[model samples]
Target: MENKAINSAYQYAFIGAGNMAQAMMAGLIRQGLAPARIIASTKTVASSEKLTASFGVKAVQDNSLCLDADTIILAVKPQVLKAVLNEIDRQKLQEKLVITVIAGIPAAFYYDLIGSRLRLVRLMPNTPSLIEAGMTGAFAGENCSADDRETAKTLLQGIGQCLWVQTEQGIDYVNAISGSGPAYFYYFIQCIAKKGEALGLSYEDAETLAIQTALGTSQLCLEQSDGNPERLQSLIDQVTSKGGTTIEAIDSFKRNNLSAIVDEAIQACYDRALAIGETYTK
Candidate 1:
């Protein structure tokens, strides 16, 4: 493998100035990467101005400038990705590392449109990245060098923890798990808050309790996860005695097939991701 300096020295260009892009840029800047080393493109002049002002990175309207960058982060939405790909000079990307945060599009789809020689990394980042507590899943294509993978991992780690998978297909699983996982937590938190409200707590109090409980539980899990394989299950079992209230709730969830419902929901997300990939690949 080449030295770390080789990978870390590359210039970054973001093709979209959206929330995820901004989150990544902010994280990089916070982690001591020079802001001037990064650049971004936005749709409108006003947006470009705002991005430049907000992040101190060069912002431009022309997407072609990104072709000159050593690393191009495709932060655009899936719907606009086709247009962006059509406009860019794919040949210019042959020597560059292209990292994408766009959901539902596989690395092979990009290679099919561009040349297969392009080094590519596909990523799925959740919303919590804005606050630096997110989880991202990354997968690199066959042509991607070890240095390219290292660079991608370093950039993503600035925002949150990143998990790398061997197969490109694993990206779709990441999409189903962590990418859409935050919304599942949000939905459950909403239900818990509502239940609290129904039980006579004020809305604000209920919401605070619900959110804080989530944070505390996650922290507890993190603290207990030091090589204890069954730590999470152990924690759950500890909370549920033979005839306790927790056991009653667990039994109710079991009777109602909650686990099956969650599995079905995750499967639905995975299926939709496959359908979207099929739509764009053709």
Candidate 2:
């Protein structure tokens, strides 16, 4: 569906102005959203002042002040989300389109805390959003209109790509893959760099090689395979010729059950996300 242009007069207010919120704020501004149309609330007066100075946005110490915005972004930590929700004037939020980047909380939890009238969109965006190369997973609540979903997608697109899922549970899967996935890749890079160091390469040189190779390989696969699993496997096979060193490494990884290890890790992440949601709802 073609996205409706976001009204320039629409005001966006972020409940928390931390790293992710700041990244989003920067992205929006870079995408031509005026700084005057954006507001942020920080925990302290000093931080609020810092944000206002740095981003040229309206910053406040009071969360209630954010209610005036047309779109409200809940960017707080999951642990503190309930407390924050409790403190806000829920009635004021009934008409506003709310988008949450907080993990592990479902729309039902918010409906209970605020009201059933709330319109919400849940997003799971990774750290790469700081660099305008992030992948975001989104889910619109039953209360949200099509325009609400489109607005959320448009806002997220400023930072990177946005993908909408069919159910809220899909957000948990997204969290496991794209959200927690960055650290997994970072860990793999570290492992490669460490092994290269042990093989007598300087740590800096090894890290550079590992990072560049990962970047190049990801770009190649994205361009050539379009994320088709069969094509991706074919790309891997291209480098894994019989009797080659690459095949030796591939055989060792397969013998070590690398795929299973990754599967288990993702399952653990998804389970933890469900547990957190359960904890909050209960």
Candidate 3:
């Protein structure tokens, strides 16, 4: 096994071949990591074969590859995490750093299950990661060294932007924001399209309009200098003409307490993530 502290070129492994795992793998592969340097595995040969075909990396049906790599990413769902962890004996990856993207699952929970002090990281990735514009939030474990964090950051950097958080509980907030955020956007788009249709817009036109509007607005926010968060209030002030349509919409949203709605949505996601880990423990 390569020393995770030192930057060995050939030291990456993924213990699950799921969606986010595949997204990260694609990001790493695109960022110039040799496919041969990374290995991935799942519970079955069929899954492994699919990953091998997709990424041209080593894929196996065993967990031993995880223990052998300098970095191991545990990508299984929270409910199946312990079984996945138990399937692989810890002595293999105990010294090797591990990164987990399971929702609502904390590293300390894994330590309690594995019964050891291991270097671990909790990662929360949004669904947009598939398109390479993801917002990923990460929090390090107690035992993770600076090198371990760099390994995690290096692995995630190419996928999108990364936010380093201070605590595992912070991952819950991440879950609410980055992890479950894309779905919320999609849901809003769907509702907007539905309303457009009800207002007599053709179905296809309404759908296209809703999708493009969201996309264009996002691009505007990203590309415009006016999108600065610190100047957000000033930006809004500039946008609102006296008694304008935008102000009417803003007043409607404020009357409905949109901020509170957004907060509750995020908190709900956080609560659910914690609940997922609780389900695993039971």
Tell me, by TM-score, which candidate is best: 2
Would you give me the overall lDDT of model 3? 0.80
lDDT of candidate 2 over 1-282, digit per residue (tens): 554465688789999998889999998887778899998999998998899888999999889999999999999988888788788888988779999999998898999888899999999999999999999999999999988877787788777888889999999999999999999999999999999999999999999999999999998987899666899899999998998899999999999999999999999999999998898788
**Residue 10 lDDT in model 2?**
79
**lDDT (CA) for every model shown?**
0.88, 0.91, 0.80
lDDT of 1 by residue, 153-270 (tens): 7788767888898998898999899999999999999999999999999988999999999999989988887667687789889789996889999999999999999999999999
- Model 3, position 119, has a per-residue lDDT of 88
lDDT of 3 by residue, 167-280 (tens): 777888887886888889989998889999999998789999999988986776666546467666665677788778889988988999999999888888788878876765
Candidate 2 collision pairs: none
Residue-pair clashes per candidate, as listed? Answer: 0, 0, 1
lDDT: the better of candidates 2 and 3: 2
Global lDDT of model 1:
0.88
Q: Which stretches of candidate 2 lie over 4 Å from their true place?
A: 1-5
Give candidate 1 misplaced runs (Cα > 4 Å): 1-9, 226-229
